[model samples]
Target: MASTHYTPAQLALHWLSAAFIIWALVMGFSVMLLDVTPTFKATIAGVNVSLSILFIPVFAVRTWLRLRHLRDHGHRPGERLAGVIHNVIYAVTALVLVTGVLMMDRPIQVFGWVTLPQPITDPVWDHRFHTLHAGCNGLLGMLVALHVLAVVKHEVVGKPVLRRMWVAR
Candidate 1:
């Protein structure tokens, strides 16, 4: 039989990913929309770049675990749609990360400790990547909203979906 609750590792990773993604989205858009000084904007961008680079490994591990789980346990009845939505979310997240990295026009400096040369040097290509990254982020935001709503809907219908995902005391 399939396990009713997610593993503790899965629970931890889920919350971690949620926190990082939400923070990035909020800070990124705020930097664009608000009248922040150029210096302040650059600071936020630098920090975000570092954080996102750090997050890539975490997301990779999470994706691996998810795939392993699906392979071992498969989906519960009537959960195929949920599985598809989740796959789409993962694909978009990968795109967002890739585009974010590719859009960089300067050397990637991580917390002042490490620096990697920019992957894309052409200004035009960088701008294209930036546009794609923004679009992907928007789609990711919508998907996250839908995910939250689905959880709320399940709860309203007396399903303990959150409880299953929640870390045990």
Candidate 2:
């Protein structure tokens, strides 16, 4: 069976993570592009938080799985570069996720269902964090683009970059 490339579980995680990240980026850009009153801002924050709850757990699990896969860097050295790139991408993602949380200016209310506590109290500091969070998010996007490019480079030019995740052997 050609060594079956990625395990089913690993493939599942890969696709799911891609979908979630794309959705999150879309939602985030939408929220930032449109402005509204504080009430609406709170509503948007609620949506972001709900999605975030899901995003965080998946991210945590993926991180755990990723840590166990250092076996990729066995020989040709591309593995080492890929590992470094992967680490950089994850670090930026963690920054965006965490700073995005700290920058919230309102509480989360699930359409009159539940209210979640606002983590940050001070408005000025929170606003500062908001700027920082947005900046980090931008950096994260760039990293993702670079990651994609690197994958293409490996697959088309150098070696099978994505074969590890997408194929298996």
Candidate 3:
């Protein structure tokens, strides 16, 4: 029998990470559609920095929980297909986030007050990372869509896969 249970920490991390990624994508998309004024760019930069900081703690906890799961359970599922897909999902997600941080070119300010050093300052570096981040985000989005299609197919046509990422659905 397949294991359908995801520990509470795992479920929480799964949804939280998904929500953060979606929020970041929406924010970036929205900001880019506007005219680029200094103040406007600064505002979006601040938001990016704040969200990146939030990513740090959540990713740390998520990684730790994953390590703990591996250490505690020597018996991992032998389902090679799902395991590979999961690894690909995380790799693309992490690449997008790390590159996004590296693409920052200006100081981040909080509501016209305090400022933080730009996460990345070099224009060439920023340009490279920006391209990579966008590319990875696009690739990751497609992969996520495929993953979701697979999950829906499983739920409707076969055994459910989303239960492993959800709260006992």
Quick one: best TM-score, which candidate? 1
lDDT string for model 3 (1-169, tens) is 4344668888899898878777776676667767678788767767766776668679778867765765666334666686678778878877877887678777655454566677877799899998998889788878877887888888998776665676756
The parts of candidate 2 lying over 4 Å away from their true place are 1-6, 30-46, 71-76, 110-114, 167-169
Total clashing residue pairs per candidate?
0, 4, 0
Q: Tens-digit lDDT track for model 2 on 14-81?
A: 78877766676766777778776777766666676777756777888887766654454233333557
Model 2 / residue 74 / CA error / Å = 7.0
Q: Can you give the TM-score per candidate against the true fold?
A: 0.95, 0.76, 0.77
Q: Clashes in model 1: which pairs?
A: none
Cα lDDT for residue 37, candidate 3: 80
Q: State model 3's lDDT.
A: 0.74
Residue-wise C-alpha lDDT for candidate 1, range 1-169, written one tens digit per residue: 6655678898999999999999998899899999999999999999999999999999999999999999989888788898899999999999999999999999999999899899999999999999999999999999999999999999999986888787874
Model 3 — which ten-residue stretch has the worst lDDT?
67-76
Error of 3 at 110 (Å): 6.4
Instruction: Between candidates 1 and 3, name the one with more favorable lDDT.
Output: 1
RMSD of each: 1.2, 4.1, 3.4
Span of ten consecutive residues with least summed lDDT in model 1: 1-10
